[model samples]
Target: MTEDAATIPIRPAELAAFLAARMCHDFISPASAIVSGLDLLEDPTAQDMREDAMGLIAASARKLADLLAFSRVAFGASASAETFDARELEKLARGVFGHMRAELDWQVEPAGVNKPAARTLLNLAQMAGAALPTGGSARVRAVEEAASIAIAVEATGPRARLRPEVLAGLRGEGPGEGLHGHWVQARYVNLFVGDAGGRVFADVAEERVTLAATIPA
Candidate 1:
């Protein structure tokens, strides 16, 4: 796809707002669950349900923690670490997938990768998971090819589908009449991959969605 061809521009401020909203959306559910569990603990009448409340608190805490760790590397600067270990990346990917309906299958060839590649892998993997709402498999693969690192994620299962806004974002275009949360992620991926002098691609078919990118190594 041509970069920014026939694309509506999203200002920096708008992009930041959309990203912040997206992250907050992901975090709120677990956070709210934790709060609700605390409320139940303080209620004397609810003492009999303490066990259920505790379970909710524990699970919500874990989910929140997992999302936080994943978000750091996937979206934040991650404390100036330029390269990331594949195993650690896999752990992060699996952590997020643990709360999802889909399963993660990571098969990365490289031992480590730079920040852009790391973000690409994590984002694409999560996107793949999102594509399979009913439950499916998201297979992530990365390999060193010549002077570039190739990353691909194939999401396949019953009812798997790609959103139109995601396709637009992957093509470096703004989301038109679509949900900004989903759109911003693909747009962010497109921007970073392009900044690294690479290209991004996406394809959607019956029960399958594929996302791929190539970044300079």
Candidate 2:
């Protein structure tokens, strides 16, 4: 690591707490939408608006489900080594990013990946999705090794802000007391990777930030 990298300042915990609260806040809207849709279904007039209401309800439910599942792996209270299909991961990633306006250029190979590793990779994808504001493509890949798996996330588009804490998280650093949204994400990723006995590497170049992880099989 360069001196610049080593000297990267840590943010206050209050900031991290605030960022985490903000991220959770965003999910409340979708949960509320689901509730509204359910209430509409109970109304007699809803029969006429049934289709629209149902659509809203289904969309909200799916979004909530995706978010929850992603959170379970990204920010949840448990981390275990299990096996999951790569196709399922791709589907999950697509669903997570589908609501966004960005166009993700995702390519996932067919393979069975350890759950801990999968969760780590998913978190990275979520981070990438947040970075590309003007819309861009993110490439995700997993390579199975004899004793471990290597997962990589590469995103390219109009340059996006790459927070130092985000990079630190990938490099196995804790949240370090910052409340920035990105910092919270970094902490989440760091915890997930650590629980899985993995290491995260980040390469932030001129126009892109590439994150990769090596997880024990």
Candidate 3:
């Protein structure tokens, strides 16, 4: 992450770097949990522990599957007609947040977004999901506006706060010293907004946080 006051577009190399980091970060936890479960299964004297290990493996595998599906659509590149089905995006978000403490309340008018804007919209929602670390609600909204589409995520819960570095990264000022691959989502949100000739903002209250980005119609 850079120290600039203005956000900049991420080049291919940078995007690749971020993707690599995030894939590892998102996949590692559940993957490790699965391995631990396997190890428990290997203990010859732990016959009675089979049921618990099986449950752990099943849950972790499901979480990994959910995350992978969401990431595939959110980060992959493809084209279909001229718009993205909002319902599909909503489903992906639900799948992702369902495995966590957050529940997504989604509202999308017109039922689709211009294909180019979908990624940013989804990324903002994902950011909102990550902000609610203490079991809260994250609302994702996409609405048609004056010559533009506005996407926002409003999250409320106890001890809700955007990590300072992540906030900075989303603001386009880079993550200061912590700019790494895991922060690419925030970076991409800002980058997409700039590419769409729009602005991004975030607000934090005592127990709430909202992150938003816009794209032109």
Candidate 4:
């Protein structure tokens, strides 16, 4: 994406288009695999491949389900209700991360947070889950403050540095040149939290990276 293209004050139509396109790009891969798996299942001559194809189909279905659940809460208009409990987000987070090499340790309370805060928490968890390029663990925690809730997602593993492009995007500096898929989450988190009367911050360390947000009551 160009610097101009990535700049802020992104019109809602354009932002929605971009997110929809990106999400479709992500959704297509597993979905295609599932289709191919079904094709293989129909071929009686390929009986040897049926077991493998069935497994592939099952996994893809799970991923598609996860993507739908995550996208609904993260990008779609949620909060038709006043607040969303942590359990819903936790279930989605576990599904999202389960497909990855990393494990997710969820500590969010049933104590509800508003829709925006919940979205911020889910994005943080997604970002932390991806931070572990190699196999590791990600943890999502919620702390109830006097007037607000603090949401945090921490990833621990070797070579756990926040992507410079993601960090830059979070700071409103735009993702660096040659940016790709990962920059999208950072962009969304920054815009979403700011609009929700919240602040996005993070800590980068050699072994762990934590993305956090403070959302007001």
Best by lDDT: 1
Find the 10 residues in a row with the least total lDDT in model 3. 1-10
Better by TM-score, candidate 4 or 3: 4
Write one digit per residue (lDDT tens) for candidate 4, span 1-217.
4446445455667556667787898799889999999999999899899889999999999899998888889877464865887788888888888888788898886478788888888888888877898868888888888888888888999877788878866765555573546676687788888887888998898899988889886
TM-score (all chains, Cα) for each model = 0.96, 0.72, 0.87, 0.90
- 1 or 2, greater by TM-score: 1
Looking at model 4, residue 21 earns an lDDT score of 80
lDDT of 2 at 205: 78
Candidate 4 — what's its lDDT? Answer: 0.81
Cα displacement (Å) at residue 170, model 1: 0.8
Give per-residue CA lDDT, model 1, range 187-216, as digits (tens): 999988998899999999999999999999
Task: Please give the TM-score that candidate 2 achieves against the real structure.
Answer: 0.72
Better of 2 and 3 by TM-score: 3
The C-alpha stretches of model 3 lying farther than 4 A from their native spots are 1-11, 78-82, 179-182
Of candidates 3 and 1, the better by TM-score: 1
Reference-based lDDT, residue 69, model 2 = 68
lDDT of the structure predicted as candidate 3? 0.79
- Candidate 2 ranges beyond 4 A from true positions: 1-23, 34-58, 77-81, 172-178
Clashes of each: 0, 8, 0, 0
